[model samples]
Target: MKKVLIMIGNIALYLGVFYALLYLLRSTYNYEATQNFAKFLDVNPAMFMVVLFTLITLVYLIIFRIKGWIWPQEDKNLFRAAGFRRLSASRVLLMIALGLAGSLFSIGLIVIDDIAKQFPSIPALVDDLIRGDSIWYVILGAGLIGPAFEEILFRGLIFRELRRVMPVYAALVLQAGAYAYFQPSAALSVISIGSGLIYGVLYLRTGSLWAPILVQNTAMSTIFLFKYIGFYEWFGRLGDIWLYIITALCLIALIGGSVYVWRTSGNGGIGEQANGSTKGGLTV
Candidate 1:
């Protein structure tokens, strides 16, 4: 119940920002103004994403402090005294394999028109990036920028906090669902959330942020690479039967491979609750 309340507030907080951002991009800023702003800033969505997410995190932290919520306890020590990292090497490999599998699985999601759509302007952003000289946008935005905001906020802040009130598994599942909602992709939403759920498990088991970061870096970079190379259209065309068929087959093969790996090598691989209050049992 506490997590639910936090989820509601967190959703509202982010949703309000999202709508404001939407309005700014659409009604407030005209095309020329938008372009001009993009030009002025090199229009790297990645950089913008970093700033936006960082601000959101800061705001969340502030809310936590004001409400006497003790989260993200400043354990600068964790970084300082690195003990034997517990992340299993086998699990790491499995996660990488799954990352690729997940991307292919998401291709099946393109079967629907609405599911084919991306974050507003993402397609255009891709094209503009191709025609323009915004190298920073592609590299910084996709690789470092987007992940920092989304993962840190959702996985680090929200999921960690939820652990205070619920079982780690429960919090992980809820965050995955929340992540799917955020992406709003058709079939891809499942992939996003499912893979996210696994990452959450890894984070829990490893007791550090590094596990999820590694997985996230791989996933985000691949997506950026797809967009960077102009192959997103092909993936987006998953609406056709052939694409779906091919994707499904590919997923089957990947799963088979993963199962084979698991059997042969042994072992399977493996966010936030909410809002400004941060008062609920959340510690980090």
Candidate 2:
């Protein structure tokens, strides 16, 4: 419980620092000035967040190193503790497949006209990015940087701590809940919980942070790509029967892919060492 409290405190501190940075930026330059700067750089205002988040991640890495979180001893690097390890080529392929299928499946669920109407509308930040002219910036920020940071924080840090004190399944659920709760809106929180679970499973099965990172990055990038290509609009235009058929196909693929990955992950159970532990005294 003490450890969990410390973990929660760290998360609070992290958020505090993030907002402090935002405040600093706001104090340093007015909104109009920042907009002008973004225009000068041929980017949108979202670039500020991209740069700010990148800095925060770097700062956290430095703090981890200084606190012996990354390199606790000569023999054991805590990067492995955070699920940074090599994966088999086959496992990598499976992870990619699951990630893609998961994204498609989630999209299929929300695109149903009834379901879409019931949920809260998309968050303004995401909507702005989708409508913005800077495609590459959105891809770099949302697709890559955002997922990397989230995987590190949620799966690498929070889930690691939870696993140390509870059952693997419980840890997965807790971490997913935490991740979902942090999202900006109810609709996103709903989507996040499902993705968070998939990401957690990927991390555990592959015994590598790269698994979730790759999966999440792929999922996000694909979403942006679909939006850029007007895929959602086109799909919406299709007849209801066709929409249902395609959604069903995506659902089948998602389930089949998840099962295939689980079975192929070998005899390791959810509580196996590969879930979040290293032989060299590293417990992720």
Candidate 3:
């Protein structure tokens, strides 16, 4: 409980740093530009915030290493400790497939909400980004930088820490909760948390940050692409019946992919270490 509390505190501190940097950066622009930029920031504050925080985290890691302050029990290599190890090509493809399915599954929420006459409220920044001409920034921020830092913060740090004290499933749930809390809105929160669960499982099974990172990148990239191409509005235009059918099909795909992974991959599920200790949430 104490550790959990500390983790929550660290999150608050991280958010504080993000807001401070955002304000400082925004202040440099003129009033009209600043207002526009602020809207862009709202589209996905996490994307920009993670850029600065990721750098800060890297520096902290370097200092901790130099001072021999970081725990030695974990792997000495930062990347390995963060689960950036190699996996078979097939495994990578499987991970991506699962990620795609998970993403499609999550869109069901949006369809349902739209039908309920409660379409998810997109962030003003996102609205502005779509209205404007340039979307390379959105692609870069949402697709790559956002997922990279998010995987580092959530799966690499928070989930890894929680696994030391609790069951893998419990840790996954806790980290998913954190993921949801950080999202822009209630609708997004639901999608993010659901996706986070699948990503958590992948990370634990493969012991690779790349797994979750790639999965995240795929999901975000797809959403950004869809949004930019106006697919979201098109989907909305499909009416309740079509949306329900699509959502049902999406759910089927999600479930089928999950079951396929479980049956085919030897390490798709969690395992315990030989020493009866939990390592990478896998049992050996």
Candidate 4:
């Protein structure tokens, strides 16, 4: 029954949000021309989707709560599934490695994006990502909101549940696939999938949600920082997917190494050693 409710709740959350978003965007304009219509909503589509999910997350949670679902409270032991018990040096290294590997995987998606022009995307999505002349918005989006939304949904909600029906590998892969499907662009599927897998693996190895969020948000903020600092041209750089891929690879290497070391070295203060535990929750 809980699993059935989870499946239903997830479907409703997405469907409701999709309907609402489409309605909001389409009702005031031509539904046929999404590109043309999207101009009116000035936020980054990714962030826009973030906002969308954040809003709908309430609906999701409300539904689950009404049904007596408890989030982050499923398996008592799995909380340490990804080795998140410490703030030690090894934990930090684990986060760095995970971040780097995740970013590198996302970087590879750039090439795939180019080769598959058939994939859908819009200029505004890129604009939203790079248009952060305001540092506060960048900080809020990249630092706080991005991490919170992603961590809660990915680690706290999804991973917490999947350990029951599947092995860690299958759980991670399926969750990654779902994460990719939620991305801003169809072209981003590979990027999202790869990054999601990296994150899931990190969670599996380390057990702490905070470590991955911290590392991911850092990477995200750094990319925005480049835009904030005007290190590259906005919108124009999207066309140069190779450079993005290369830069992503370098950044990934740096961060992934840092995360791995943090996770492994017991003496390090960021995350703790692996423990044999599993936990569950259903916060909708």
Candidate 5:
């Protein structure tokens, strides 16, 4: 509990610094003003994300080393202790495929939104991003930077720390909830929770942050591609029955693919303990 609290406090401090920097830059450079916050973000989403994530990564490294200085560890690899590790070629490919499957599962959220009429309208910022001038920025921010930072924060630090005090499943669910809430849209929040759970499971099975980060990038990139090409709109025009069937199939694929990836990726590798000890493996 103490560890969890400390971790939360550290995360809050980092977020505070990130937003402060963002506001400072916005005021200093005075990014082009717009009526919609979403439009403002779309104008240079890449610049904002690249700067934000770079700062977070730097802050994490500094604090990680500072903690080492305070405690004086013989081992200097705090990043690995936090779950950052190199992934095998096979695992990398499998993770990317799994990410595609996860995106398919996310599509079900659109169906749910249509049925419930509860999903918030897509933000203008997001709409603008899809149609924005700079494809490079979109690719950089959405495809790479966003996934890297989110995985580092949610999977690398938050989940790793929570697992120290609780069961892996409990930690996964708790972190998924937090991930869901962090989303910009309610519809995306619903989908993100599922994505987070799958990513958590992947991290647990591989004992590496790379798996989740890769999966997240692939999934997000696919979504962005669909949006850019109007594929989502075309798909939405399909008959209700077809949509239902596709949603059902996607759900099955998500579960089946997740389990297969877990088994193939070393059959549930041992989870890391807080003090860097090995523990009993978590199997499906």
Candidate 6:
């Protein structure tokens, strides 16, 4: 319980810092004016995301470095301790595929049309991003930088901390709930929880933070592709039966991929401790 409180405090700190920076930037720049000028120059408002995420990354590094300095032995190279490690080329490819599938599965679960309905602002935001001239900025900030930071925060740090005090299943659920709680809307919360679970599994199975980061990047990139090509609209036109069928297929693929990862993992799966210690080979 104490640990949970501390974890919550940490999450609050991160979020507070993020929002504070966002507020400062918004106050400093006239977003609407800049956006209008950007339109004239064939630029995108999504470029703001790149600046925001880059600054957040710097803040994270500085904060973690200070923590390391205070607790040298236990917290030295905190990111590495959070499972930032390398993997083979083949495994990296596998993770990417898994992430793509996971993203599709998440969409199927929610039904993209329903998502648009439940949270009108979401599709509006995506539309702005997809139609923007600085699409590369969108890709870098939303697809890569944002997901990488989230993987490190949610899967790498929070999930690992949860695992130290509870069973893997409990930890997974709690961390996913934490992820969901941070989302702005109910539809996004559901998607975040699902993706959180998938990313957590990838982190545990591969024993590397890169696994979740790569998978998350693939998932975000895939979503952007789908939105860019109007895939969601096309699929929505296919009626309820087709939606059900596709959802079923995506669910099956997601489950199969998860099973494959679980069986092939050298870390004894999620049953093992976050620190790679094992009491018994208990499967969770």
lDDT of each: 0.53, 0.68, 0.63, 0.55, 0.70, 0.70
> What digit string (tens of lDDT, one per residue) describes model 5 on residues 56-166?
677767877777788786334546666665567777887788778766555544534465355534334345455556766777887788888888778877776677678
> Which candidate should be chosen as best, given TM-score against the real structure?
2
Candidate 4 residues 106-153, lDDT tens each?
333333445335543532343465553356666566545766567667
lDDT of 1: 0.53
Model 1: how far is 195 from its true place, Å? 3.4
Candidate number with greatest lDDT = 6
* Per-candidate total of colliding backbone pairs: 7, 1, 9, 54, 1, 0
Q: Model 2: how far is 217 from its true place, Å?
A: 1.4
- Whole-structure CA lDDT of model 6: 0.70
Error of 5 at 267 (Å): 6.8
Please provide, for model 1 over 52-109, each residue's C-alpha lDDT reduced to its tens digit, 9 standing for 90 to 100.
5555555555554544435554322212111112345665665566556655555344
Q: How close is candidate 1 to the true structure, as a TM-score?
A: 0.56
- Which runs in model 3 stand beyond 4 Å of their true positions? 1-50, 63-77, 102-113, 122-133, 233-239, 262-284
How far in Å is the alpha carbon of 188 misplaced in model 3? Answer: 2.4
Cα RMSD to the true fold for all candidates = 8.3, 4.6, 5.6, 7.8, 5.2, 5.5
Per-model TM against the reference:
0.56, 0.79, 0.71, 0.60, 0.79, 0.78
Give candidate 1 regions above 4 Å deviation.
1-42, 57-91, 107-132, 184-191, 230-246, 249-284
Ranking by TM-score: 2, 5, 6, 3, 4, 1
Model 4 — TM-score against the truth?
0.60
lDDT per residue, candidate 6, 27-127, as tens digits? 64457656554453234545666677678767877877887788675544546656776666777888788777766765554455664576675566566
TM-score of 6: 0.78
Error of 5 at 66 (Å): 2.1
The residue-by-residue lDDT of candidate 3 on 1-284, one tens digit each, is 88778556645655565566556655745577567666655554544544555665665466336534555643444454566656668777766776565555545445556533464464343454344335666667656677777787788767866776687779999999988898877876876787677677776766567777777777666766777777777777777777777777866765565456556655533332212323342112
Off by over 4 Å in 4: 1-53, 57-86, 93-124, 233-284
